[model samples]
Target: MMKYEEEYWIDYIKNNELNKKEASELLNLDIYSLMKIGDSLRSFDTGDTVSYAVSYNINYTNYCTASCPICAFYTPYKIKKYEINKPNKKGYELSLDDIKKDIEKAKALNVTEIHIVGGFNPDLSIEYYESLFKEVKKYLPDVTLKAFTIPEIDFISRTHGVSIKDLIQRLKEAGMDAHTGGGAEIFNENVRKLITTPEKISGEKWLEDAKLIHSLGIYGNSTMTYGHLENFDDIIDHMIRLRDNQIDTPGFLSFIPLKFSIENTPLYKMGKVRYPSSGDKDIKVYALARAILGKSIRNISVYWVALGKEMAQIALLSGGSDLVGTAFSEKVFGATNRKTSTSIEELNHLINEIGRIPALRDTFYNLKEYY
Candidate 1:
């Protein structure tokens, strides 16, 4: 840990020479803290575990300029010579009527939140969402609408020559209630350039965007796209950056660890990239996040698309406190070659299997009860 970052608290945790919170002095935590948090959760679990809620990933467009190597969700994306080709989708954009049907289906299924996300579609604008969000709100105003990423906002701003600040404002005013934390690949530019680009805004930029949204009384989640070109130092640096951001604005409800899926992307084929630790690596990642972030961040979610439901259950026992996305009919994985979605009932069973109760919550972690 000292090799990664030099600090007294980090050294004390490595040496195991201090007491619990004493070692956590100045907000540096270690593996033992993770075990303590898990233990505390267990002690507090009164046979009343929180139920996982209904959420859906809304991919507005399949187009992207990022061309991230580990991504499986782009259309007409240029890939390397060695990677497998993804199936072609005739349509790149999800139509306004299609979005309406999705909303109707989500309402019929009683989804609490619609996680709207997609590529950096140049044609997509505030008007696109205005029509989509207005229709969704017309059908079901109660459902929380979680949408867009910092990069998406940036892309929209660049395409329409609007600032990201105003773009976010328009989206919020239109209907988006929260952010999805997608653009934050890694805070370090060197790592980002390998996957995304330096122009895509740094992790510090992501934190600023999150702060702006949180300042408006809206909440958003944060993420780390791990198991990619990043070194351990870069990965840890990303987490530390998010943690620092939380100190300023604590509205981030959870930290999602995005596992890199290598297929239909340039990095995997052309650059000869590999994700050696795919699923099992998350145990360490989640445990480390819980330890490092300590209790300041309430939930650490295991995204099932990246890690399957069974593995996510294992994560819950290890250190994870939330199941991310909670999506139905997720197209992100399909874009990546692993088309999969889980219903609320399946999520409930998964929570039970992991020895935790499934609690349905809105985009902001507000529990929505069924009377």
Candidate 2:
């Protein structure tokens, strides 16, 4: 184990320029000391207030072409068409009407953001998204529409024969406020090849696309799906890549660590990953993220749906500053048998229980109100 003076680590945190070696050393520190340093860094950057968003998750469709081994949400197109009967079939391509209904529900609940992400279905045209965004803006003009991951954008751009630059410009015109941070399972190419399909874009491609998105004056969050096949070094490398990008583009609004949901997925059946990440590991990851990313990425969100409420609260004290979102009607995690849906009152209570002020934020981390 590498040894460093406590004051030295504190100076690095104060300077907010921890390199990979320094970060790795921090990760090896005792859990309590690590959490203390992480919490202190978080306090120095962003004060005691914890933030969340009044947002709804709209999974437009579960019919996917990628069929990644790590995903449980997607249904094979063939199985959906042949094996499943009409009334019993769980897979679906949601119609415009269904999307409109969801938006209306979100609007009625006074939601500030609408998160739209789904499986990579090749059948959906660019016009489908344009029309959907147009109608969503027409219905809820004030709500922020954070849609599509970089991989999804890459897939759609390739399928539609439009440049990604052009696609993003058109979507911006159609009212896409920002992008989500899904599809970034792990940045290490070797691990990605083992878990995700070739249909998914590479991590390098995802970062390039993110730089492009940032160049367009739109900012999006970054994410890493951990606790599956990646080791600590892989996790550190992922955070370092994100840190380097933020250093250049400075467009990432937050870094969210999504704990892998291991149930009912192909990875589970293969007996490669046996259990969900422990609370200890979850807290450590959140802390290491804060320790490494430092001030460049100000927000670290503990995905409540993935970590569950109790662990999520503990994570907030350790390093996380955001509770992700309400995640109303979320389906991706549901396919893995995890529940993240919560009421506004519940969210407020959770944050408050941890002695932090609970604030509702928009897609861009703009504080809407404190309850």
RMSD of each: 6.1, 1.9
Query: Which pairs, if any, clash in model 2?
Result: none
Give the winner by TM-score: 2
Question: After aligning candidate 2 to the native by TM-score, how far in Å is the CA of 253 from where it should be?
Answer: 0.6
Clash count for candidate 2 is 0
Model 2 reaches what TM-score against the true structure? 0.96
Residue-by-residue lDDT tens digits, candidate 2, 1-371: 22355456766778767777777777767787777777877887789989988888889989888999999999875576675567877688888999889988988888888899998887788889998999889999998999998899999999889998899999999999999977889999999999999999999998988998889877889999999999888999999999889889878999999999999999999999999988788888988988888678989988899988999888888888998889888889999988646899999999889899999988898898999
Q: lDDT (0-100) at residue 326 of candidate 1?
A: 64
Best by lDDT: 2
lDDT tens readout by residue for model 1, 160-191: 88876777777777787887777788888877
How high is the CA lDDT of each candidate model?
0.67, 0.87
lDDT of 1 at 347: 79
- Overlapping backbone residue pairs in candidate 1 total 10
